[model samples]
Target: MTYRPATAAVPDLGVLTLGVEEEYLLLDPDTGENLAVADQVLTTLRGPAREQSRQEFRHSMVEMVTPVCADLTELRDNLVALRRSAAEAAAAAGARLVAIGATPIAEPHRSVPDKPRYHAMSRRYGPVAHDPAVCGCHVHVGLPDRELAVQVCNHLRVWLPVVQALTTNSPLHDGRDTGHASWRSMQLERWPSIGPTPHFESAADYDRTVDELIAAGIMLDAAMVYWYARPSAAYPTVEVRVGDVCPEVDDAVLVAALSRALVATLADDVRVGVLAPAIRDCLVSAAHWRAAHDGLDGELIDLRRGGTRPAWVLVNELFATVTPALARHGDLEYVRTQLDRLRDEGTGATRQRRILERTGDVHAVLDDLAARSRAG
Candidate 1:
């Protein structure tokens, strides 16, 4: 079934401002190998782009954050500019900025930056810290109160797998198809606290759980909670950290629009005292694994019902659920068109596999990713 936009009048546009944080890997343009020159690349950025960009835990990776955007159009423009500036900086530093979710070509040893926190993580986590050079897209929706953010997380839990399925960009790792759409998601499972956020009694309960994890040495700090959706430790937003960093600008914009609309809808539910669904955590985790394995190319667990359904069907349901919010934010038609485009071209994983199947070369996949990454 097709998604229909809501007929409600648009609401005030300032309710839930949104922003995006995307992490990327630098690669040798000719060899398609990971390059450990993030520092050099950062030096090449100027003005606002440089301010929004920072080095990630791994020396081979960099992250670009968009300023808080009031609407999807502003967010898209910021993302396009950020990607252009980042690609230019990487080129200046003798590398290509590719937005694939994980490093396709493996390196013998990946280096951590010289920061104390990064070094401590490397020393403590050992192979877990060193092995995977994965990246993800984090969407932050404005919510000032921690209690409301926690409630919103509960509302968001059921749809996390669907979100992951929509943005599965990391199919290949170490120059091989890992038999999974988002290998980056699998790689994160090794971490201590990384999955769907649990149902919380209140914001206090959430804080206590985080404190307990830290006290038990399961997490380094609040920032390391790493749940798929959580009250941001650094910001007043509910940060949804489920999706792989999308390959194309349109994909990222689609994710941002859906995420903001979802948050706005769920927050309204919270205001009206709608209870969160009581799905089993194990089931949610299983659904996540299924999404990581198949992306949108196969069926996904239908949480509302008892059986699995095609991934696109579930995505349609999500759009239906959040239609009013989409309409309020002036994103209904844009999201509709983008969803059609996504279905036509396929998810990033599908595109990557298609390139590999046709060309029989991993470098060709990287070449396409670099070109798309720079494209507006």
Candidate 2:
């Protein structure tokens, strides 16, 4: 299949169009276990007045992408509507909806969704690829040009793990502590061309990389880039694919908001000929290690200043750097509130561990995830 370009020319620096695509697991409403019934839910929600449906590799997992949102207000409303429609449809079918980076204990042996794409993935990726429990948060932000998009991606490589750190929602997998905040990140790292992408000097360079990878038989198309951050093959945006599945819809919005600010700031810098600081691969890997080991509580490696600092400190610095743009975009209050909430309440990764410890019931943890997901 031919893969179309992921970018289009946007004339001005006017507010960048932003949207988020979330993957959710379909589960039995009562038991709260993964259920291969997304087809049923899709059938029920088909011919929709609001949202549209697309196919996924697994019938148990469905993806929802909001329309292009001009600003934060529209983004919020769009996501709320999509979540409500999905929840109502799933509930009507006696199925539950859950948002997590990776389901806590999904068994790979459970029937694959019986879909052709899933079957192909199973055959190609074998066990790790066929894992029925994986889910993710994909945020798409507008780019002015393809070459600039490649530059943004090159600069974004170091900070991709930082974004992953903030949205570490999957701590438990296979009914055990996976010893990582976003275990899905660790799990997906097993795949070829996975994790942080390399620096691309221009659009031509990006195209050549993909072509070479395909010619080498490592990938079939541009869709196979599959890096934590990549030029979206389907949308005119840069899709940040590093975030774990968010346990709460609000956190999902927070992650998306921050992503927009980050991208916009980078674009401005690019326009002014100010490139992002170069952090070596060793230090970048160390930051990823810190995020996985300590979650939000861990200290991250400061790539620029070459020192260590608390993750929240880095988050605050990031916000401060982007505050001017946030104020201009009228999203400052929302971003501030979100950072405060995460700091005060902790992330889904921390919350999952706390809930399991307090209740000592895996089912209770799953139930809470589903409940929180609907609170949007």
Candidate 3:
């Protein structure tokens, strides 16, 4: 089905709704290898959850999206349920679930899942498609006005690196560093439709851009505009599609919380007539560089000040700036605890590296993820 843009005449966007999609790698618990078994698993999963299996291309490449959520509580509950069901479903099919950004054990020639859409992409993207080893967590925040959506997307171009730095879950690709914290980002960037988006002055402008891209044969439609952040064609939302798929559900929730808070904070500022100064393209470049290089440890360029700041420092500032918004959304405690967990423990990438370091087997990392997911 084609997508339709949301109208700007809708009421206040403050009444937030959340939708999240998590892409997972199918794994064999014993060997930690990427296994093309998602289809088998979904078939074995009985009950209402089985309905999702028929919703899209599935099995080897599984995607679970939460029902449109009215608030954070509902969103959290949906996430927990989906994760639990996925684990159960995987176990039933003699497979296991590991929610890293990309599986380290993936090989380019490892069999691709046999789905029509998968086939289409492979036919189009060729060997570049073989690296479909990556996974990601996408969070959707409602946009009350289409015009404001463009503004939010423009400002988002500057913040994506921060999210990437915080959620660098793919430190290893095909069992090597690949020199990128999130190899999925690098891999996905190869597509013609991926990258930062240009600023659109209005909803009509955005429509025009999409039309141009489609006419030029660059993409099929708005859904193909796979920027780090952009207006959603499927819903009245701005979807942030950057971060690597986080292993921990808490980490996912934290990222979603922060994203919602950031968008809402920016929207509120717009409501009150606050204008952000134009950030140079270089600052955005530096921001992405910092994220790709340092992950959590490296310094990120602060867009507002045009200076380098510790990644965690920027995270802290984000938490602080969104405190009031979090309170309003009734997610302050959840958001605070999630941030504290990252601060006290470490990011998924950090924890995975430490685990791999101790055991010297990449399988141990997968096992650890599977164990935590079960506990959650």
Candidate 4:
């Protein structure tokens, strides 16, 4: 897609559109096991919804991307309609659509999709490719300038852990509690390119690093540069890949709203000649690990203070930082309410653990995820 750069003048927050891509697993409702029926499910979608959806690396997974949305309400409607359509399609194909981050129950094997790229990836990555299926929510905020997008990523680095903490839904994997809020995060870190993005000096520096990784055979191409945040290869936007796939539409929208606001606030900082903070890479990685391990229930590494603080304290700080942008984009009230709901109801990981604790059944957890996913 051809992208035109924004004018010299700093654009209003409203001009930065939002788009979300969510990956989901198809499961057998009765067995609570993954069902490799993505092709069958795809055939059931019609028209624009079909165009918006596609099969992922695994035959048991399907992904849906929303069209560019001017505001959160439009994004929510698009997501709801897409989820409803996909859930119905899965039902037609004799499977249930689930929005959890990773497969809760152990599966004997997950088949790669019937595509040349997927087959090549499976061959190259081996066990990493064949691991239990995992899903993530990728949020894209409009920024046509690649240089600014790279800078925005630098500004976004510190907030990655906070966002990940809010959307941890993969606490259980391999039929047991993995003892991590986002087991999917740990699973994805096996890839060499996955983790916190380095502080790039400029767009050239970012491109050079990507080229070097590809040349060294660490990644197949630019698309495999799976840092938590990066300049999106497919679109002219900064793609935030930190969060697991959220179970409910409200959770997804809350993440999307916060992501867009963060981008807008940081873009303004870039325009005003603000330099990105000089945070140590090692500390940032440590902070992310803590977010994955404890989610919102424990202390997170305090990047600014050189110590740990309650996760909710850092979350509130993030909100304070982005409040101006949120208000400018008319998302302040919605974000506030959603954050309240999150505090009261807990993260998806917490909810899943509660169900397992109360019922002592893994299948019950899967059932709840399936029902919420279809609730759209």
- Candidate 2, residues 51-151, lDDT tens digits: the string is 55555666677778887788887887777777778888788777788888776776434456667756666676677666656788889998747777777
Each prediction's number of clashing residue pairs? 0, 1, 3, 0
Task: Tell me the spans in candidate 2 whose CA falls farther than 4 Å from its real position.
Answer: 1-12, 47-51, 108-119
Which is better, 2 or 3, measured by lDDT? 2
Residue 42 error, candidate 4, Å:
0.8
Q: Given candidate 4, what's the lDDT at residue 289?
A: 95
Best by lDDT: 4
Q: Candidate 3: worst 10 consecutive residues by lDDT?
A: 1-10
Cα-based lDDT for every prediction: 0.89, 0.76, 0.75, 0.90
- Quantify how close model 4 is to the true structure by its C-alpha RMSD in Å: 3.7
**lDDT for each residue of candidate 1 in 150-241, tens digit (9 for 90 to 100):** 98899898888999999999999879899999999999998878888999978999999999998998888888889999999999899999
Candidate number that wins on lDDT, 1 or 2: 1
Task: Compute each candidate's TM-score over C-alphas.
Answer: 0.95, 0.91, 0.90, 0.96
For model 3, state the Cα shift of residue 354 in Å.
Answer: 1.0
